[model samples]
Target chain A: MRRRSFFQVAGATVAASTLVLAGCKDTEVVQPTTTNVLNLGSNDAGVLNYAYLLEQLEAAFYQKVLDTPPADMPKEELALFTELRDHEVIHREYLKELLGANAIPTVEFDFTSLTLTTRAGVLAAARTFEDLGVAAYNGAGKLFTSKAFLVAAGKIASVEARHAAFIHDLAQAPAFTGVVETSGRYTGMATALTPLQVIEAAVKFFPFTVITSGLPTA
Target chain B: MNLFKIIAELEKVDPEVMDRLSHRRSALSALGDFSKKMALAAAPIAVGSAFNKAMGQNTLTDANGILNYALLLERLEYSFYDQALKAATLTGTLTGAARTAIETIRAHELAHVNLLTAALGSNAAPAPANGFDFGSAFATYPGFLTVAQALEDTGVRAYKGQAGNIPRTLNPTVGGAVVNLLTVALQIHSVEARHAAHIRYMRRGATAGAQSTIFPWINNADANGAPAVVYGAGNPVATFPAESNLAQGGISNLATGLGTTYTVEDVSAAFDEGLDNTTVTAIARATATF
Candidate 1:
């Protein structure tokens, strides 16, 4: 029995090390080598990396819009987007700082899927990023083993929710009724998505694949 | 049989077993005595009952405390909006967008109250001792929006303060139920933030000078005519800092880390700070006037 248990432990350790090696290789290679996998590491690190990637996507999106805003965009609307851009940049930089050594390299996104030349289009895209961000943080909250990380994530989560509300209101003015769970046991609660669900939804904007299997499901 | 050994074995399966047992130390001691008095088969039954009792009490003492506090805030918000919507004075002055937003927010608040009450079950906090009176807030549109923003922003901070307290476990069966509490709290927390942003949007549109300062997200400790306590720090200012706080995770100057020329207000608006339970309760009670 003791020998069998030792073998089982050794087998698990080997498998874990293989996974770590694969993750490291994925990060080391810049070019898409058949599959450019972005492995969000395990446990709290995985959660932080996942958040950092989302912030990167958001910061990049807002920066693009601010760089070349639509002609029809009003001054007030432009100002709002500037704040959104600043917040996303701050979030991106802060998260990158948090991840430090565990942080994935700065991602090069493919924003071709989005329509950035028109006012309505910009609002629509902003709505998508903001809503997805809120749901991502909400879903990822329980996966954190560290309370400080959880608290820090919570701080950003609400801010993202606020951004979602503002963007949603702009996209659908006079009738924007904040993001609520329309159908569920918690009907009035906010919507939360699993990391897998979030990645699936957000994969279109990514130039490469994001492997979230390393992340904690619970 | 050794109770400690049994617990140790259970802990291997359910890591949160210690958390569940710690809350009911007296029950654990009683469990040991009861186990010795019973047959081996009966010991398992007694052990199960003791654990259930422990978990139930812990839920009441910890999780329920947070939920009940949330319930009170929800009730307060629901009542505030309910009263505003019912009042012709405020409704008369509201724009189509403002009225629609308030109605939607009021419904969401009511739904939140229902959700928390269901989560708390019989342990739900009773209705506020004193009825809510928005005072002159009901007399005008701006007044209503100001109070609404304060309430919603406070609700967001209050929920964030309690996120760490929500329990989770590795036990697949019971873990789902306990973690669901955390999930529900988070879901509600964001909704409160959404409401806060919407309220701020309406307020900014109504007032001219409020644009630069009053965006959907909070700007520094600028209370914007609501209660000052809503934006100020809690009892332990270090743990629960004011809304203008810029530092996070022991990094003193966030601007230095971000390598940006962002002002104090910009840095402050980047992150929302939490208000501890004591501060949140005092603010809520002060606003709960008839």
Candidate 2:
């Protein structure tokens, strides 16, 4: 959903507070309502922003789910969601600090496609998001010039993969194949998508368009 | 005269020549002597064989060495799955989704082997298909899952360790190739983590009450269900802590208030740590016995 739409649902006061705590004014980070494109810069900055955007989307997603938790959600599952949300927020803020002024403004996400009221729907959507995060980090790591950044991405990618596996099992008990398996492309490795491919899949849940040409291909 | 200056003088006499042919022969002779001195004392003939091996494997200095190490891990992982899939008892032991996951993981591992082998080309390490004794590593499905978790976790750590070996820039062609290989390594690395997580989940499924305590993410080397003993105590102290490490980029998640309400354990569960080459190789060697 658009930022305004999310603010409307979550209450503007809370949104403003969150923005301030995240280290930026809403006006400084959020773009004009008419401008729908978010440009992820080039090189290391672009990749860090790429990661930051994904983490923001994940953190927001988990927060929204927790805020309006389905009544049927089990306690264990609720705890899992809380942990996932916390991890993503940690990752998002870490990238923001690493990127400093170069970081992309907080991009708006649209989870309208998901049916958040049901356990099955939430888990399934989480599986998709988690898997996408893994794939995106996998592909984006090589684009970074700094070994420090590559290793950092590696650290995060593995955790994302774990989350993907857990969520996949939760979505379909005993169906753990999807998270670890990929088609026999790229020499039988798991899915690793270029920025364009990742952004294409991710944009469906984003309210605004993500122009990924600024991101590296290799 | 300095070697380059001599070569430059030689070039004046013969523009097509890059360096002196006699000098190249002497360099090869010196390399042979160095290899002879480094050869296995028990088997003098092994020196010739070692010398015959690709130069890339001998020089573990840069990206080539990283690619070689990656190939070794892939071969190990691929053979593990390949043998497990072929085991006669596996058919009756693991059914349904578990079987499917195993098959899928096998395919990915084999793919990684092929991809890394292709990337390494002549420098590819010897495949240990004949040497890998799956029976010793894991005889039953549950045993298989335990070892699978170990190997996959090791693979993830190994790749992360080697990632720093990739040079940021080189000749465009070589640099591009390194980047492609590094990307491939990253892709396979996360897949390995997924494999570890799923294997942990499957183990939890078999054990009735493990879910509440068991986590998919790596904790202290001894945490969760990680078989630290199988890895042996010979592992360097630095590498052991690395597997279950809770810190990253000098920032401790233990400190509160970045943006989460999770406790210390949850914070630790949120990140996987990287293993250095010595530790990863030791673990791989211990497991490779079977």
State in Å the error of residue A26, model 1: 17
- Candidate 1 docking classification: acceptable
Please give each candidate's TM-score. 0.79, 0.73
C-alpha displacement of B244 in model 2, angstroms? 3.8
Residues B140-234 of candidate 1: C-alpha lDDT, one tens digit per residue: 77777888889999999998888877874422112134436677778889989988988887777744235446678888899988998999987
lDDT, candidate 2, A1-218, per-residue tens = 88657656865334423432332211223222356878776766678788989999999999999999888889888987887887787788767755556667876788888899998888878888998999888878878765556766777898898889888778765444544445434545667788888888877887877867767765
- Give the deviation of candidate 1 from the true structure as CA RMSD: 12.8
Q: For residues B1-290, what per-residue lDDT tens digits would candidate 2 score against the true structure?
A: 01122222222222212211211333223223322333222222221222222211112457667777887888888888888877875667777777787887777788777776777667777776566765565566766777787888777777766665665443223313433656666777887887878887777775323455556775445434445743232233322234444444323333243443455655556666656666677677777773
State the lDDT at A34 in candidate 1. Answer: 50
Kindly list the interface RMSD, in angstroms, of each predicted candidate in the order they appear.
13.0, 19.9
User: Which ranges in model 2 have alpha carbons more than 4 Å from their true place?
Assistant: A1-37, A173-185, A209-213, B1-59, B86-92, B134-136, B168-179, B207-212, B220-222, B229-241, B252-254, B257-262
TM-score of chain B of 2: 0.67
